[model samples]
Target: MTKKLIYNGTVLTMNPDRSVYKPGYVYIEHDTIREVGEWPQDGSKQALLESASWVHDAEGKVIVPGLVNTHTHLFQTFIRGVSDDMPLAQWLRQIIWPSSLAMEAEDFYLAALIGCIENLKSGATYIMDHHYVHTYPENDDGVLRAMEESGIRGCMARGGVDLSYEPKLRETEEEIFANTDKLLDQWDGAASGRIEIAMGPLNLYGCSRAFLEHAAKYSERRQLISHIHVAETSDQIENTKARFGLRNLELLEAVGLLGPKTQVVHGVWLDDGELESIARAKASVVHCPVSNMYLASGVARVPDMLKLGINVALGTDGPGSNNCQDNLEVLKFTACLHKVNQLDSTLLPPMEVLQLATVNGARAMGRERDLGSLEPGKKADVVVVDLRKAHISPVHRASSALVYNANGNDVDTVLVNGQVVVEHGACTLVDEQEIIRRAQARVDRLRAKLAPEYPVFRVVE
Candidate 1:
């Protein structure tokens, strides 16, 4: 393994002690960390230095474990600002569903590529994309190829639904299964551990019990996470209760789908019993605070869940709901929103909030052993923020500033598995100008074709 040294930086570590605000150095050996902190100049350290293939100056940057986005629709990066000012159900029915139905394979690839660039530049090293818009099997391969080309780690969930956003979205179960099988076979473990495939049933209301069972069985056999949308809204919960005679989480549990590998998104309306169920099942939740606030969905009892020892991670959801795919914004919003909601300034402190974005997210996606922290034998997934600036200067507390004040524009560099993917606020894998042009053009065409009555596209320059 090649060795690299990153010297003269403040390492956040996010270790067990929640260590913060310390000047330290890091040693990287290929995909794993060798050592961190200002160590003694001993003989063993000399030997490690002699083995180094390269060295880089961190130059007073703030080093944190790469952010993890546990739930996102990367393909929806093109839909930013489209379905604003609506309830979740209405947003899905009137705008999101129609736009997705109009998407083609090229559109999926371009959108996913741009989403990857946005995520990496914002310091998120890993993404769990709940891809639900594949109209055909070929698009699945297209999306995974885009993820590979962008050079980010991802968990791709093949979104399946027996029903559609409207009567128009209904595909035969055969079609769903065919595309799903194709997705799992092609995208699972693609790109040498940079990408993974999982079962993404759109939501409980849209899928039949049999489909849920099949997804659970397949996920278990493969030891993959079963990602789904559950209890995101009160209406959905009520509808599920009225139809299935149980709440959404209860329905999922009754169908034998609640387990360690299950990851549910939003979960704004999960009751105490459901929280207990999640705690007992060792399942995880992806909390999209910005999206939930945007849609006016109730605040997900996140503090309660945290107190119950349930694993909760941060996600931006999608551009349509979040209006942007910035993990830095997610971190800041998550940290402050909960404190305000609970009427206590101590709700989610900087250390705990940072953990939600990194280690907790890795645990949710079943990649905790490999991708969460700057520890030995873990992947060299890391991000550097320029803390010399005025906003982050006078660093009394690294976690406090990172979680409360820092933004995506402050991210100076990002690395995935020891490779530099984003540098100086731009992606190394794809051309930024070309991506913007193609994204704008695709959004225009889609608007013209699907929502002509809305307006011609007017993207801000």
Candidate 2:
């Protein structure tokens, strides 16, 4: 087997004990980690390191596990900057739905490729794209193909809204379930298990109750994940209560959809009881601080959720809301937003914030054992952030500097499953510049398809 060694860096092992090794080394064989600890001093260890097939000197850098983004609409990358300051409902009515419904397969493919390049540079090796735009039958294939070609671990949570949503985004019963099954047969575990398929119902109000139950059961029998947006805004909660006479999470529980594999996205409006319900069901909540604030969707109860034993992960939501696919930005926003929201400086330190982006996100995708930390026998999904920049010069605490001062541009190298997908701050597998040009061109074309005013919120029912 081929071997590679990376040493002379600050290794942030987000393990159970949260170990940090300065001037450390990690040895990998093939795609699995073999050894990781302090730099070797003894001759035998040094000799063993010299026997590796390849060695990378990560001097003046911080080596950490690749960040996992639990929730994002990657296809929305094409519509970024479409509507910046609009309210959440209006933004969806005007920008997200209109542009998404206009996109074809090629649109999804190019958008996902662009999103992958952005995500890779930001140190995210694993991304869950909550893709539901199904204008064509090949839309899912387009997204998954980009994920495979870009060499990043991804989950296309194929989402749908059968009723009470945009009419064009919905599909017939046979098409929805049959398409899901066909995708499973073709691409569920493709690319050596790097690509995973999950069941994603767009939202509670958008999907019917019976469909939610069926999706939960479908995923449960297969041991797959079920992701959905839950109580993201006050209107969502009010509407669910008005129609079903039950709160969002309560309605989910009544439909037998609350379980450990459920990933609740943008859980901003959940109350105390709903938090308790999520904790009891062992579900994970994906906190998108930047997107929530951008859309004026109030801050999520992240501090309360953590204190109540609910696992929380971080996400950027989508480009339309966040305008970027950088988790480093999300990390800083998550820490700062909570600290100020709770008026406690020590609310979320940089170390815990790193966990929210790394381990907590891994748990949300049900890949805790395979991903999340740098240890022996785990997948070699690693990222190297150069701390030698002028802004990050003389770094005292590596994690603190990474969380507070660093952004996506600080990442110098990234690896997914021992493959160097990004090197020297650019994607290695795809043409970054060409993707940019094509993506911009596609966005311009998509803009032409939308009418000037769109009749003001006619997309939403």
Candidate 3:
């Protein structure tokens, strides 16, 4: 097996017991870490030659487990910043759906690729993409190809939303099931261990009970996680209550969708009982703090969720909602916003926030054993951030600096499964500029071609 050594850095394992920052050297073999310690020492030269391939000097940079994005719509990269200030319903009904409907398979491929590239460069090694806009069968193939090309580890959910205010957005039950099955068959395990597929049954208010139950069963029989949107907005909560006569989490539990392998995205309006149910079920929650604030969809009770023993992961949501796919910003916003919202600076402590972005996120994605920490036997999913920045000066505590002060721009290098995906703040596997150019061209064409058809939102500049 191939091996590599990364030494001379401060390592944060993100493990519950050994989560604190400590200086160390890590040795990796193949895709798994072999050994790690506070200092490097000479080993048997013959054994080293037989296994080790290369060695990297980290130069005292801070090494942390790569960030995990629990929820994202990679195909929405083209709509980033288009309707930044709109509410959740307005953003979805007006700007997002129209643009998404206009997007072709090629456009989606480019956009997903761009999203993956940007994510890796920003220190996110794994992303759980709730990729919902598959207008055609070919679109699924294109999205999978883009994920393969980026070399990032992710679970791509073939998202299906069967109800919308617009009739065109609604789909027949047969169509949704067929598409989800086709997507799963096509790309479930396409990239050796890097890419996997899951079922993303849009949201509670958008999907029927039959659809949710079917999707949950399908995922269970296939041994895959059930990815779904829960309690995202106040209106959705109200609608769920009105129609089902139960709250959102209660609806999910009644539908038999809440369990150990379930991941609920954007749970911004859950009540106390719902929170307890989530913890008891051992399910996960994706906290999109910036997106929630952007859409006025109430801040998630993440600090409380943690207290109740729920796994709270970080997410950027979709570009249409968050306007940017940056986990660094998610870390910062979650740490600061929750503390202020709860009026307790002690509420999401620095180390806890860091865990949400790292280990908690990995757990939410069902990849904690392999990808969450800088420990021996874990996957070499790692990120190196420059600690010598002006904003990060006089670092009293590494964890505090990481959650409160560090930005995506500080991520200088990223490695996924021991392969360098992003170096010097740029992706190594794809042409970043070419990806951006094609993405912009697709956006421009879609806007120009569909401008006249859209009445609620202007598609043109």
Give one digit per residue, the lDDT tens place, for model 3 in 1-461: 77887667777777768654356767788788887766534543335434567766666478888999888888888888766678878787778878888888788889889888878877899998887765676877787788888989988887776665446567777787787677677677777778788878888988888878887788788878888889988898889888879888999999888999989888888999999999999999989998888888898888788889999889988887887887887888988888889888878777878888888888888888787888888988989887778989778777778887888888888888888788778888899998788778888788787667765335545
Q: List the pairs of residues colliding in candidate 2.
A: none
Least lDDT summed over 10 consecutive residues: which range in candidate 2?
A: 452-461
In terms of lDDT, model 3 sits at 0.81
**What's model 3's lDDT at 173?**
72
Candidate 3 Cα deviation (angstroms), residue 293: 0.5
Q: CA shift at 382, candidate 3, in angstroms?
A: 1.0
Please write out the lDDT profile of model 1 over residues 427-450, one tens digit for every residue: 887898898898889878887787
Error of 1 at 59 (Å): 2.6
Residue 234 in model 1: lDDT? 90
Candidate 2, lDDT over the whole model? 0.88
Q: Rank the candidates by TM-score, best first.
A: 2, 1, 3
The residue-level lDDT of candidate 2 at 95 comes to 79
- All candidates: TM-score: 0.94, 0.96, 0.94
Instruction: Name the better of 1 and 2 by TM-score.
Output: 2
Give candidate 3 misplaced runs (Cα > 4 Å).
19-22, 40-52, 453-461
